[model samples]
Target: MTDQPQGAPVRLTAFVHGQVQGVGFRWWTRARALELGLRGSATNLPGGRVQVVAEGPRAACEALLALLRGPGTPGSVTLVVEQFGAARGEAGFVER
Candidate 1:
């Protein structure tokens, strides 16, 4: 479930903070993105932030952002910093 018949695709780069690391945040993002049929990657960044790059339909990406803002997981998410734009040729989702 990494892709679907969707509208004009887009991309979203997000920085999620607040107990993001060591709490399956990246894996959680991957699962959610797969469910949305999105393509991207979720990585751990410095300062305890999880960096996620998602590419898919605009609505799907936005939906992913919403969950990133408050997705239920092992840790509490307090913030999800993100920027949206046109897709940049990203493929399958990854965790790094």
Candidate 2:
């Protein structure tokens, strides 16, 4: 096995679409990430997409991603995740 830590946190970019902006998406993610003891930020992109970067244990990160892609109202949300290497050193979670 490798010598690296097993539970080291990660950095991921999640693109949430469909009624994401102005729909409390950032708030929801911030709340959830905090509850999960994760750190990162969520923001609205130019083209109707909400982007989030969460850094924490793998399990919690996965849960956050699942919620981002869950079913919704008439205009349901779709989450596209792009896993990055890891969190360099983000301070905390916030809206940007």
Candidate 3:
């Protein structure tokens, strides 16, 4: 079987870098996450990094990571993706 986490929802955080800030990454993530039925938020950090927190099914959360690392808006390119450990039971995704 696949090594997916079971029982309860999975909380995930990803640090998206390179051409993320000011390129609609936050808005993209918020919309996508909501569409995928996940809860989290995306925001621009101080150092031109976009951070996203997503909590949902294992497959859905993993898919979000892929989207974050892939091509973003009109002028966005993902340089790297750094994923963190699991966190659970988030209220919802918000822009902060």
- Cα lDDT tens digits for candidate 1, 1-96: 225345768788988879979988889899999999999899888889888999988888988988887546648888777887778899899999
lDDT scores for all predictions? 0.85, 0.76, 0.75
**TM-score of every prediction relative to native:** 0.88, 0.83, 0.81
* lDDT of model 2, residue 71: 62
* Sort order, lDDT high to low: 1, 2, 3
Local error of candidate 2 at 24, Å? Answer: 1.0
Candidate 3 lDDT, tens digit per residue, 11-56?
7877776777776678888988998999978877898887789988
Residue 30 shift from truth in candidate 3, angstroms: 0.4
Instruction: Tell me the alpha-carbon RMSD of every candidate.
Output: 4.8, 3.1, 2.7
Compared with the true structure, what per-residue lDDT tens digits does model 2 show for residues 42-88? 98899998788988777788887776776632245865655655666
How would you order the candidates by TM-score, starting with the best? 1, 2, 3
Instruction: Please tell me which model should have the higher TM-score, number 2 or number 3.
Output: 2
Q: By how many angstroms RMSD does model 2 differ from the true structure?
A: 3.1
